[model samples]
Target: MTKSTIKVAALSAAIVTALAGCNSDSGSNNVTERPTIAECKTYEPTQPVIVKGDNQDLNFQTITIGATGDMHGRIFAYDYALDDVDVNAGFTKISTLLHEERAQNDNFLMIDLGDTFQGNSAELFNPLPIHPVVETMNHMEYDVWVPGNHEFDFDRDFLFRNLEGFNGAVISSNIIWHENAVDCKNTGQETPFLRGYQIFDYNGAKVAVIGLTPSHVSSWNASNPDNFRNLDFKEEFESLENTVDEVIAQYQPDVVIGALHHGRSETHGVVGVNEIASKMADKFDVIFMGHEHARFIEQIDLGAAFENGMDDITVSGDKANQVEDKAKSGTYNWRNRDSKVKVIEPGNWGWALAKAEIDLFKDQDGNWKIYDTTLSNRTVADVEEDAALQSEMQHVHDKSVEVANEVIGKIVGNFTNTSNGGADEAVLEEQVLNSEGQRLYTTIHSAKVSDMPLTDLINQIQIMYVEEKGSEAIKEQIKVDVSAAALFSDASNLFNGDTYRRKDSANLYMYDNQLVAVNITGENLKAYMEWSYRYFNTYQYGDITVSFDPEVASFNYDIFDGDIEYVVDLSQEAGNRIEITSISGSDFDKTATYVLAINDYRFGSTMLVEGWVTEEDKIWDSSNETIYAIRDMLTEYVGLNDLYRTEFENVNWYIKQYGPSDAKGNVADEDKGEILQLREDGGEGQDLWERLQNKEICVMRSGPGARDSINVSVNVDNNNTWFVNPNASNPYEGCTYSNQPK
Candidate 1:
């Protein structure tokens, strides 16, 4: 057979085990006859009578086992309680796999690696007091069920009441009862309910299966401290090893298996299944590990032992892979050979089912031993639907589908493309021109502008900032640059793309406006007249530069010269850290005011920009809202063709010519200047005020009797100010200088 054909054949053989048995039709019809405790204990297998002629004979013994994981029952299909068909289909598939295996082998055991309660709407939304998941698992009739960490999501009372109704054995070796507490009758703490080991006798062969759960229950469950208050979780490996030793010494079982909740790696390691397989290889003949959701079938050797006059090998393996290493030489060893013990994990949410077949043979000493084992997946797609289970889960499935189909919102435009072109001409440039004739290259994209409201944006920014940098870091950065004047200073011009290229979206540059300040002295004002000549010398931006005379005062600033006349000495100015000493009277306040021009990002008061709250004379609240409104207005006005336009008017060209010069006539290149003019509705300085005004602005007051002067304060007992005015007609206005004290 071809490799593909061989693989298909092996998979088919793994799911179904055919064992030859006598025609005991007498007990076949006794479905309702529950065997007594003594009768069930004494049940023994009868050897099949072989019809042999000459030297020909036919007899075979096989047992099939099925495993699965993560059945968070009682939970709705999803968070919204939609998509119940998928959930029902999953349960149906598991049920079908179970019955199929049982049909192939009379003695078949089905185990579930847990996580069967408390998730989604079913658990959260249901009006009924009892957990529906408990009823479903009980109906499935799992032979053995292990408790997962999430099983305790519900309080202990609910767990006890529901588990009491389950027909299967609920096992956990790590949970220890408290010395002073009275046993809860319905819980695993009750007698006979809590079993360290269960011995199953199949055809005169005894197989002992030990159960263990992770000791770190508190780490996963918040309610664990309350629910399992009377119980102590012991070390997993230590508890399992001790239990296995005791069981082996007492029962001398032919095979040992462990149902373990702990994975092999550190508490939080990747590929936890492999780690568990490696560490516990020497402990058990076969181990079924959970906690980590991974699928594999491999064998690891534990050691060699003499059983039934034959050298029996104890191998560690999973149901996904069939070969494992043996630790006969003190260290775990593995060979590329067929495996005996198979571990399997059917991933979360009943997405898949795992099946294994173990062949048992008797040795010369009449002791049974595992001869061989194989594992395979019976895809959920292949299993026929169980009508009863489907009927029960139909309502949930329909609800889930309905919720998934509804649309949340619409995308009116495409996302932004940030790729840089190879050639200069290949670059796309767009500019914005202020009414004063100042021009700035402004590229408006969807990432730069979106449909989300400005208020929502501000809320997100504030929440994100607080989450990333502690409240203290935010406070410090604000205190350092309140006016945000230094925010555009030379020190802030440092840019490192490599260090900033983080995968997180929060770390990316999100400002929508840029500020540019001009400081000209009377001595250099004449030289600065030639700024237009120097500006046009640089590479052409989106539009070609034009020359004009400097006849208009678009902005207000001081004209300083080497002569001290009219040159206000700002050396003693407390908050004049931006180096511009003689600011407009309207720009200064005895209350320590600031003028802030920012983009939608800054106006939203995103923690990404420091000092938004602490260091501004005045902020424009129209930041994010203005952008959204502009987009909407532009969409209507331009119909999405080109929502914005810019022209290099006369004043912009005149100012660009002189550029920025030093004392030695060393001219600074405008093109190389880190500061770039961002073109939005508000000009650089005015934009900050607009953003602040658009936001929920607040005015803060500090000092002993000054408390009532300000409208609102961000934090009490501090000089920090907040512009909590969301309805300001113009968020940014002239700063009012105050000399009066309360």
Candidate 2:
């Protein structure tokens, strides 16, 4: 082919490529071939994007995106010791880095993905005044912000109030406020309270940033019925696709990016960064994801992503096989490279900043086209703290510490997250044991009775509250058992001291799990314990540790109390692994039915394993929607007793099978085995996961006066409204609202 002939063929291919990318279509192979309109114009491009570039032209412009999310109100620096070297992070450090980045690049956009206005001791109060985090972001001049899942952790009214308080534009494409939802100052209508997307005309590029919140919002906010009841969240993938198609037709942006509060993984039907890249990555240029509180820069190839069921493939032929871009780094597509979807997530708590650098050039037709890119995160520890920012936020910090220190109660002993002294660290160190044997001796499973403090305190408060608040008949006839998720279950602890402050309360509970009571047969109770124990991988002999499945959050694993003693047989499969050793200090009774005190989460949560609490099992409900209702109740209980020392109690229940057993199902290990009574095995845990893991824990009940002092709502959310079939292993119910009065 002559140079002139080759130029013509190349020009034709470039025009088709630019047009295909802008309109989100698969371009044709042969320049002479006239592809069907359906193939190239199913969704009209923003139009006017120049399609005249040859294969060797320089990009028109370069744009840099500096984004952060999951701030969690860390307006001030937090302390930690690294190799005995103290390090800290706060908005002050973030501001310094951000300023430096913006100064270096003129074409820059600053964004916050979400999870602000909550996380600190102050957020638990929902101050009548504005939060410092919002003000600091405003001062920093953020260009855009997307509300994350934690933003809904506040009261029903605080949801939009905080979002509106942001200094920059806020958008969410999938959230539609319910008609009777709590009234906030909502004037926007396309998707009530949330604008879909914003288009920026910058440096000759029409870049569009569309916002998206996770689709499982309802699941996470179920405990806060007042807030969740009025919000309609559509599936992420569908909502994102429709929004992208609409934005393309309306704005014809040179590049499109997604600002989503979702994360990298494919969580059910939610369309997160991974989902977008695999199915719609070629459609949108870049995505900033939040929610998992992790940090990483990765790419997704649509053609390759489809192998994992990420269907739609728009980029085709040679373009699909193009070499991976410089800006796109890491192997996250389960280690495949077949398409182009770039995603960024900065760590939470102002720990790092994700800077995504990309270059773009318009085709001869004047449309912007992104060609290459690179990304990296700057840790706050590496950057100098901004003095001015620190000074500005100092007052906020002082005020929080003041409010947190207000004494609320007294404690006798420190509640720590450490496991039972791990086989005497000194003794274990003297002997070089095998890895498996070390695990067997040091690891303390959640089932051990000694590991029961955190759960015991919360459950005690729950049972006591139900006793005092239930109807006189209920108080007289019903014996209550408490089910707590162990607030400080992992490595968190509540310090023991002469006096406890509000900060202790804040530390004690991290979720808005309201108090709830329900009825369960002793048989289902066994099933519940079985389900809880299923989380732990079977204890292996000669192992230093027992690990649980992370996919199944520890928060979902409830620790039951109130005179019931059960032995967990991890060797058995789920649904039948619980062995009821004793009940109320007597032989286990399969026929006994008991009134159970629980958080609204576990009572109505869809994350409950196999066959547990059916919607019909829920009976009593709390009027107040306090996130830390258990803590508040505990404070009241302590006040009633007028304690001056620690009030947390040791649970009476004991685990029968703690370590590995023999070939006959009996615990044979010389270590803490079956009946590894308290003090022998690791004592009660220091903490739980701190907050609800399964956003699906949103199953909530009666609002305000829906019930009186009895804590039982004759008129309430139906207890029988879960799982359409109620018998299915994995439940999927769309309509969760059940307002019919009992």
Candidate 3:
């Protein structure tokens, strides 16, 4: 028998022993019980068995492939930032389910769809030759690995080191060497940085797996060109098509799989995995997707339906359906596209594993052809973590925990209280740190919506860093006039007392974003503010609650400080939300230029994409300094000044039309008293304001807030016909805005 056959036979025999362990209820023995992998009691296949051919021959084998994506470095069932045990998901938990699946299948192969080694506690191990994420994968014996966009978040050398440390075959067909790189020895522009695909021969049956990373890595990481200094990530579709054709021609594989590190839904105008799988249904048998952090199994129809179907469908002629038309139809199912392809994503953070079982049979022509395929996500919610793996990774976990608990500085006050004109103090939800009465207070509502000390602290730090430690050229040219920052986490907070740990700082500023100072035109600055305000949905009549647009990411919304004053009009649509009153306390100028402080991510994803600026816009970047991470800078700043004080007053920007407006939904100066009274009154007014703050009510009006008697609409029991007068003593006369139990 061949080596593949021998391995299959051994794995097949192990199934009996695995089943015995799973079915064991023996209670006679009193010996010490070792840590064991959990049986898959909740492992019910979600998708039905898909069969393509009929063959009842002995020359058939079932190959099981397991996958995980966008892990974001959750190797252990613990949150290092939170400094608590997170029993939800981890590689240790996933290992249990993986072991169970491997024992059941005759042949097994494991793959991680990339985005490992970057989030939370994962970066703590970056200095090591083998990162904890790669170490865990190596321990699991992963067969193939792909690179995600975040893999390029660090320096080139760190990424290369981890990739080299992995035992698995690293692959990304789209990544190639840049021609002008000094380090380009044998790898010129045409040479791929890693293997494009890996062919696995199982008993002479070849299975080809092609890997593709996000094509927008260059744009995403443009802030630090050195991160991907010698690499070029080609477009996904062309690269995938070329690689698939080459793999088929060279290997003549019986089965083809796509290990793609792209989301299912299109983002930033990039083609999503769903669309790619649909367009290439005839070429690939299975495709695993990542980066969206979702778990699902979906299939698409082939040939006629695949080409002619609407909404993410590809067509050939004049009668073809348009994607825009389908979008306008308002019934397009983006989750499950109408095409001939099998796509699966196993979520993120080691919560679930993507599994694809392919049953191959020797056809009449003496060639191996796939007969049956099944795709599903195996969740590890009910499974116990692999004790052996957890033990091995114990040192890393302990170090992370130690780092998390280490006191970085002393913070005596809160960082989320409002100062300009709203709530005097943020409603604090006290969290007990330990039995010693140490505490941290988390804000009940998102500080991103309004001016708060937390975000102001970030903006202040950026301006301070650039002015004091900026390049000599930047100091000579101009000082930072404005700075913008986003509250990455809603739970961001400082200690209520005098003790602040490293975790507290991490909770406030999570990512490893570097500080950047850029020269921006007044026109572009206003436009940038408008784009950031797109996070809020336009206010409507009877909208008792303020809401955000689902399409816009919350992190993209930034708060401006340092010599700028603006008002965000929620009543106005995007591109028209920001009403800048002044710059440096003077009249706003649209033609003038000013220095703006921001993170590198904003410089790439926003400023560059919007055509507001280019690489030449940058005056200074922290990547050239001693510390690059914004989180680390904040920590250092906090350490230098032990007392946590609001360095800058939260008066730069505030929101308009986020509360109860006048009868016509207008913000009349005369109605200010009534509005505040209504919000303060313990009756309908207070109810309205609280509901709006809590996001429990949405009141929609018929027209602009200028009418004296505007019609307000509120949804009541699936009905949107409820109308009322906003100026009336009981503006909610006909509208029951509250959906809560009375």
Candidate 4:
């Protein structure tokens, strides 16, 4: 074994010996004494030994810790998937900052909080003896390493190789090798997959860093078992506290840092970082977290109850509004709390570096204790990229960029013209203006308002995949009558003149989610559609834009295609919005069963959660077959069919009642010249009118919670609702009130 591998093995062995209660074998001359659970249970914190003539007055030392997480393969200052230059983030920028921080601080340590080995072009180099990202981390001399859930996205062997290659200690307190699992590490016996925690010596003081990965990886990757094959994750709270207790009992470090790969909020059974940090506040001093891809530095008051209940304690970066009774009452000062723990998360893709400068002082007894800590998230906006590091990884960067830009296929038609007389082939893409009048050229804006070729392409590919590669039962019995896919990104688009590239495919389907076909009744299907249509706000008089419910994510708004016709009437409330007219050229049946194609995330999180479907209802899955992920499947489809023929007729759904309709069920000529004139006068409702002409919805781009009070209330005059803008003192500020209209 190499030096790094040997170091990891030795360290891991010692950790396993201490935690697993492993006894000395018959071959051993002496009985090796290891800390038992009973002994650990009775253990107390260790006391320090004082040296004579050690002056307590001048015994202060400041330790600086710099951390980054969710790097996601951003080794260079570029997005390999988009083939776009990223000026904001990259490992080189982080390296420059780290180097600068190291020069300024007497005691400095670098840490990476994990999710390092996957995403972008990182996977392309996985087959290498040492992955470039891991090699880069090794070069940077990372002191403590935590493995996030995404670390298991690839094969177990690949993960192990990279971990073994990493020079730093791989510490994950919550993971253990399964009893029946084959030893992928090639060790003679089964042991903990990684060391629980690593203790670092800063000058004379010791700092213990405990690493925690999310426990919900198995649930997230239920469709793909091979990702985390031999590993089992323990409950975060129980495992973390136990490890902390053990660390304190064995070696009472001056400082304790939680390097967590979990978020602050409790989501989908994954324990929140705050829950552990709060309940175990006496031991922990500082915590660094990741996996939510957010950035923030907040001092959490320990053992304090949240004013709005447990679920209300959220610290989502950029959008956090944490309210606590203690905070409001002025009893929850960060430094004055019973135990103050500062939590910091550096935003994903190397956007910022989370720093904690902790000052410690030696007491009369020579016991080192924390005096104070300063936390900040330093942005990489103005930092110069490390040219040396970038130079070293240039070959990999070039290859990734080349792969991203490699043309797979071509699109011949714009797919916009359903009627033949229009310039379909000549039109590449029409530049449209948003409500703000900013010129935008994209497929997403139009796709969201009505059925478009982009989503239709996704739906068609899924249906074709099911028909071609599904199981015998699925193919013979249930036909894929309908398929649904979300317009995953606002950047996803297809231009008539442009060729399909790898980036194009990736942009179209941004996730690694597997395709799943579930059986559902027409009632459940309609219910699902209604739930999706709830993303839009209800229409009201003098309403300018089709706003979104801030609570709803756009990705959850699935659009259906294939042998189906439906209308989303924004005038109606959510539950009554979806009106499915027909399926398979027949009247919609509420009780009749039909197979629906959807991504695994939606199936697991929504379909299963809502009790609308079960595992038994699943007829086919891309994971069970040899089909690629939806993104790769898109590329494969493009490769097979070099030229896309946009005989695009799958405009199966549309919105209604948002604008006037004629006797022929089309947008009627406005007899109400006041409304037309009001729209023509510009501002507020002008863009909505322009969009109405194209059968599109004008989306409101206000930040979340900004539109909460924007609604329609029933008017007493004619049972018609008027617009209510929360920000406007006069509700109908710019527009004419309906009492004098028409």
The prediction achieving the highest TM-score against the true structure is 3
Model 4, TM vs. native: 0.74
Task: Summarize candidate 1's per-residue lDDT along 471-546 as a digit string, tens digits.
Answer: 2333433211111111110001111121111011111221112221112222232222222122111222221111
- Better by lDDT, candidate 2 or 1: 2
RMSD of 3: 13.7
RMSD of every candidate to native, in Å, equals 25.8, 19.7, 13.7, 11.5
Cα lDDT for residue 731, candidate 1: 26
lDDT of 2 by residue, 1-742 (tens): 0111112124334434433322211111112322121211121112223222233343466678778888877776652111011133467778898789878876778888888766664353354334557768866767777878777656655654555455456777877655444452253443344557777666557778888887666665555566655567777777778888988888777667788887666544445566567778667667777776654556666645543432222222211111223422543221232246677666676667777666776677766666666566666655677787777666556556664565555565534323332222212211111211111112222333244455567777777666666544244544675455554323234444556555555555655456767777777777677767766555433222234544454556677777666556654666666666667667877687766777765664443323455556655555442223665565555544533223444544433344433221233447455223222334321011111111121122221111101111111123332112231332112111221122
Residues 307-354 of candidate 4 have per-residue lDDT tens digits of 322222222332222222223223222245346566778777887788
Cα deviation in Å at residue 254, candidate 2?
A: 2.0
Model 4 misplacement above 4 A: 1-58, 179-192, 268-270, 274-282, 305-337, 415-444, 471-478, 523-542, 549-554, 569-577, 587-590, 605-611, 624-627, 643-648, 657-684, 687-742
Please list the residue runs of candidate 3 whose C-alpha ends up more than 4 Å from where it truly belongs after superposition: 1-58, 183-189, 267-269, 302-339, 418-444, 471-478, 659-742
By lDDT, the better pick of 2 and 4 is 4
Alpha carbon deviation, residue 31, candidate 4 (Å): 30
lDDT of the structure predicted as candidate 4: 0.64
Candidate 3 per-residue C-alpha lDDT over 208-258 given as tens digits, one digit per residue, 9 for 90 to 100 = 888999988888778899888767888888999899999888878878889
Structural similarity to truth (TM-score) of each candidate: 0.44, 0.69, 0.76, 0.74
* Model 1 weakest lDDT span, ten residues long: 645-654
